[model samples]
Target: MEKMLSVWKTAPKAGLEVKEAPVPKIKDNEVLIKVKATSICGTDLHIYEYDPWAQKRIAKNIPYIFGHEVAGEVVEVGKGTGGISIGDHVSAETHIPCGYCYQCRTGNEHICQNVKILGVDTNGTFAQYVALPYKNAWINDKKIPHWIATAQEPLGNAVHTVFSGEVAGKTITIFGMGPIGACAVALCKAAGADKVIAIDRDEFRLGFAKEFGADVIINGATPGTDTRKEIMDATNGLGADVFLEFAGAPAAFNDGLATLRAGGRASILGVFPKPFEVDVTDGMVFKGITLTGINGRKMYDTWYKARSFLSTGKVKLEKLVTHRFKLFEIEKGMQILQKKEGMKIVLEP
Candidate 1:
């Protein structure tokens, strides 16, 4: 009867509670990890608020541990779980795909029809211990810091979004300067984007985006400001060659589209609350814009690329980690996120 402390969602409300729970036991194909570090995610924030999307997506089961991004040391490897062993430092790919699904077989496991996300569909990493399928475990390089190691999942999202289109020698505009959006700024610059424009309502996040290598920063919340004009001015009046929408704000979506040049590419990773009206015929068809809906990392491909960037020091996230807390302090961490008072917060369990 081994007990562990966990953050549990006791109700469909705006909070989480720390309580004692049984340590997760691994299945034959799984491994048990003693979580060293985990980060708060925007998806976790959505669930914390019990928003409409969370209500619709989260299963009826309450009192489940929920957190996805994590890095930890393997303490136990279940029988038949090969390639992973005790003492391995690792992070996990949150999307646990059913390997036999059509999407998985077709090399699109990230969008597997039977995908179950960690912390969402199953018990997540917001605890002292978590059991995950061995396939989802990514062994971390010893040189990677625990916080950066835990951040790879979201960093992979930014990697997938930024590299979805040709970024080298391109003028790119990223709408939303949240953690992932800020990650995209550094990634795009490292990948050789000629100009990277970061837009967000929060100046604090904009400052971080600049620190991450954004060539231009625009406050979308500024009154009487024309975002398109600012982008056009920065892009020599030709408009941005690429637009990445990570804000999920309808206004940001429209602005990104408006500032995109004809034939430009747009990769959207943001999750919208509800469908909004968009002039698809004019904005997409006539303008010949290539729009891609990004879901998650491309199984192991994006993970490898993201790891390379982090290991080579091309992408630095140390500055993005603004706060740290122990497992019992998750509520305070969530509060900081809700108030938009911090960037990335890491929790050690």
Candidate 2:
């Protein structure tokens, strides 16, 4: 009777509890990974708070393991699991797409109609071991640190958003400085954006944006803060060439659109709590703006890009990992994230 420690979402409330559970068995096409590192994501925070979105989405089962960003070593490979073998370092692609779906067949597996997410739709990786399909396991370079490997999933989101439109030699404005937003700042810089402006209410995250190579950092919370004017001033009055909305706040969404040049492209990856009206005529029709709604990474393509960014040092995540906790200290980690006190927190099991 092998057992493992797991963090369980026992209720639709603001806390998670540690409990003992049997180590999961792998399916014929899956492999078992001995968890090494996992990270807290904004989605995890949403579930912890049991917000309106989470209340509507999280199933009633209530006692499922709930973490997705993870990196580990393969300890067992079931029959039919090819290529992946014992002792391989790996991370998972959270979205498990059905190979036969229309989206999957058309090269949009990241948003497959029948996709299953690791933490949200099924048992997740916030435990000593997790079993996942072999196709979802991404092999990691031994040199890549465990925490960086775990950070790749969300980092992929940033990569997807930044590359959604042309970024090279363009003026870019990023609204939000959370972990993924911070990653966007760095990615935009690395991809040769002529200017990068970062906006956030949090002073710490603003500073982080600067460190990540943002040319200008704006405090969106300050009284009389004019994001459009600041962006226009920085771009020589033409407005930003590209606008990325990673902050889900309604104000940020509106401000981001307003700050874009008439023909600028906007990539939105933020999850809004509720639908809000935007001036479609003024913001899109009249302005001729191209709006792209970004979901997760572009299946395996984004994974390759994220890996290259990390391996080539084009994007550095070591500094972003501001804190670490043991498996038992997950509650403390969640508390710190709630306070917005850290960049990335990794749980070692």
Candidate 3:
């Protein structure tokens, strides 16, 4: 057996174990990739911490490798993988759609009824190499660097959220400063948003969010801070034209709605721990606001938009990548992530 170093959730508990495991073998319809760079994601954090959600969903598959965001080079091409050849640079779409589903048949494969996430439902990419179906591999432009390519999957979430409605000349307020929120800031600027207001508790993240083109920054965690008033003031008392919810908190949900203008739009991608209360009458019904629940990227549509920004240099990810470590140093990066002290941390093989 050809062995490779992989990070695995060896026990049904928090933390992962790095070990020498057999390199994944590709199915006839799949391709084997030598991973160049991979990034830590919030989903990976949930699994690593063995949260309730991870315990319920991932525990059954306890001893599998776990990570999804990745960029790599094809090293072995399976016989049935059409058009994909050795040495092709690729990043995968995390949503693995079942081609025969109704959603897939209707061009909404990203929401395929039988969708199996790349890392969650199957073995994943936190290793020297990863293997997956060729359909999920998106070939990257040669000009894109490895770290930037590793970020494309998460960046697609930001694209799906920001572009859910009109962006050009609109005042957009994003609640959260995580990787996706950081990506949202840069993406809004690239799309020509007039003003981008960023709200977060973490100063470290807010500091760099400015460079990502956030016009106004607010620390919502500060005691008695009136984030709604600040956002209202930034938009000339008209409230923000759009609200993006990525904080995954009840307060952020209310703050987002409270600051949104009448008839405005809200795109929610945040995953809440559980359901909570809200004032729909005042915040939504009377206001006639449009709310779209974003699940994942719109398949290859979001991929193209994200690539255009990277290719044109409209969104530079260098600053967003706050820390880089060798693959074996995953612990250091995970600690920084848990402490909310790092943005997009990449690990190279």
Candidate 4:
């Protein structure tokens, strides 16, 4: 019997129990991974809190493991699997897209109409063993640290967001200092952004932002005051040329829109609590701002970009990792993330 941890019920509040489960069976085109490391994400926090979105998407079951940021060593490969073998280090794209879909054929598989996110739609990696399609697995430099390997999912988000727009030599303001926000700061700076400004309410996260090459760190407590003022002042009173909103709060989106420079590009990577109104007419017309939205990474395409960014050595992941926990102690990790104090938190299974 393969033992695993599963979220049987929504936290309904904050704390949820992990139920032990048997290891999953693998199909011919899939591989079984013994998870070495997994990271808690913002979505996991929302799942813990039993949000309406998760309620609709996640099946109501006794136990449902919800971890997408994962890395592991291949333990078994079913018949017909290619190249990958036992002991190979790997991380998955989480999103398993059906190649037959229109979006998939058009090269937009990331948003394929028929897509299944491992952690959300099916059994995820918060266990000793998980079965995944061979196509979604990505092999990295064997020397890559397990901690850094688990971060590929979030880092890919940073790549997809910052690189999608014109970021080179432009002043950019990042609206959140969460894990992905911090990653964006590093990506922006490494991509030759003229300046990088990080905004967040947490002083610790803001301080951590500095290590990620943030030229300026602003506290978002006084929304309409110093933070916004500093961002504007840093951009020659014009406002940031690009604003990447990683904070899911509506306030952050509003502030991002207001603080964007005329003809600037804005990328929205955050998931808001619910549908909130944004006065698009306020600055969208006058500013001529290009607003971009992000979903998951574009599988192999984005993964290749992210890996290149890491291989460059210009983007640092060492200092960003501040906390680590074991798989059974996932509860504690969740608590730390909920408190929003640490920079990057990793969990070992």
**Local distance difference test values of all predictions, in order:** 0.91, 0.91, 0.91, 0.82
Count of residue pairs whose backbone atoms collide, per candidate: 0, 0, 0, 4
Per-residue lDDT, model 1, residue 168, is 98
lDDT of 2 at 346: 97
Model 4's alpha-carbon lDDT is: 0.82
lDDT of 4 by residue, 245-296 (tens): 8998888888888889889999898988789988888779877889889898
Q: lDDT tens digits, residues 71-108, model 3? A: 99999988788878899999989899999989999999
The TM-score values for the models, in the order shown, are 0.98, 0.98, 0.98, 0.93
Error of 3 at 108 (Å): 0.9
Evaluation by lDDT, superior candidate among 3 and 4? 3
TM-score of 4: 0.93
At residue 244, candidate 4 shows an lDDT of 93
What residue runs in model 1 are displaced by over 4 Å at the alpha carbon?
none
Tens-digit per-residue lDDT, 56-167, candidate 2? 8885747799999999999999998889989999999999999998989998998898988898988999999999999999999999989878999878999999988799
What ranges in model 2 sit over 4 Å off?
none
